[model samples]
Target: MTRMIFVNLPVTDLGASMAFYQALGFENNPTFTDETAACMVWSETISVMLLTHDKWRTFTSRPIPPATSSEVMLAISCESREAVDDMNEAAAANGGTADINPLQDLGFMYNRNLADPDGHVWEAMWMDMAAMPTDT
Candidate 1:
């Protein structure tokens, strides 16, 4: 058996959020989708569940922060720096805000952050293990 991760996020507009995620490379799984919720498959082991605010409230009583507030930053790895940049571009071209943080380059690693229309933060990163300096 393998472990899987399902991140549930509250979306004000289900359709727009679905589109936003798709632009960033996730595929919507119709099997778990409905008017109030959509299952976005990032990989076989990672799925992002976008739930409407109404549907989300059913699971928790915590108030959703205003769209301007940052809650959590979900970090995802990419194969190369180009891959990270591409996702950030796609996210901004669609509806998200790109460069929420300055681009970070640490010789062996690179990172960029973006915010979705609903204000969910996603960190796109790339790392080259072979290029990393070894401990003496």
Candidate 2:
């Protein structure tokens, strides 16, 4: 069986959250979408489930954290540095805050962070393994 990961997130507005994710290259999986939740697919093995506060409560009793608090930051790999830049630009243009963290460029690797409207942080990175530094 193929292993898969589903990241579940609690959102205040389901529709707006869906749109925010869609803007970041994730496609809506209608099979798992409904009024209170949406399944956004990033790749074959990865998906994000956006659930409304009420729907989220049904799964857990934990209190929802404020948008300023972060439990985790998700990261995705890009094909190149340009791709990373493009993703950041797209995020900024689509209601997300771009470059939330200091941009990093280590020659072999480049990274930028962005936050969704709901303040979920995501890192867009590109790395060139061949150019990675080696211990002398």
Candidate 3:
């Protein structure tokens, strides 16, 4: 069986977080959703667990870093360049903010960055398969 990945992120508001993801075309998985967290299904293999700050605190005794000051950024790839633009638009319409950087267009790839309500950065990228290297 193929391995699946679940990324857990902290959010200030569960409902708004869920709505933000939904705007990006992700659907909530009812099977693992509750008041504390919602399982957002991005694909068959990828899922994001949006956990409320209070719930996330239970996992660690140390203080949780605020999204604005997070050390790592999350990136998600789209099927096409148009999809990347669409996602960015959706994010803005759903309460997220677009990044300040200029758009990147390298012929073979296109990318844009956005920040969620809590300021977690997410990059939406699209890569051309034709430009990718193949195994020897």
- Show model 1 residue runs off by greater than 4 Å: none
Q: List runs of model 2 lying over 4 Å from the truth.
A: none
Order the candidates by lDDT, highest first.
1, 2, 3
Scored by lDDT, the top model is 1
TM-score winner, 1 or 2: 1
Q: Write the per-residue lDDT of candidate 2 for residues 1-136, one digit (tens) a residue.
A: 7999999999988898888888888999999999999999999999999999999999999998888988899999888899899889989998889999999999999999999888889999999999999999
What is the TM-score (0 to 1) of candidate 3? Answer: 0.91
Clashing pairs in 2: none
Judged by whole-model lDDT over C-alpha atoms, candidate 3 comes out at: 0.87
RMSD values, in order shown: 0.8, 1.0, 2.2
> What is the Å distance of residue 26 in model 1 from its true position?
0.3
lDDT of each residue in 55-115, candidate 3, tens digit only: 8888876676776585567889999998999999988899898753578888888899888
What overall lDDT goes with each candidate model?
A: 0.95, 0.92, 0.87
Q: What is the clash count for each candidate, in the order shown? A: 0, 0, 0
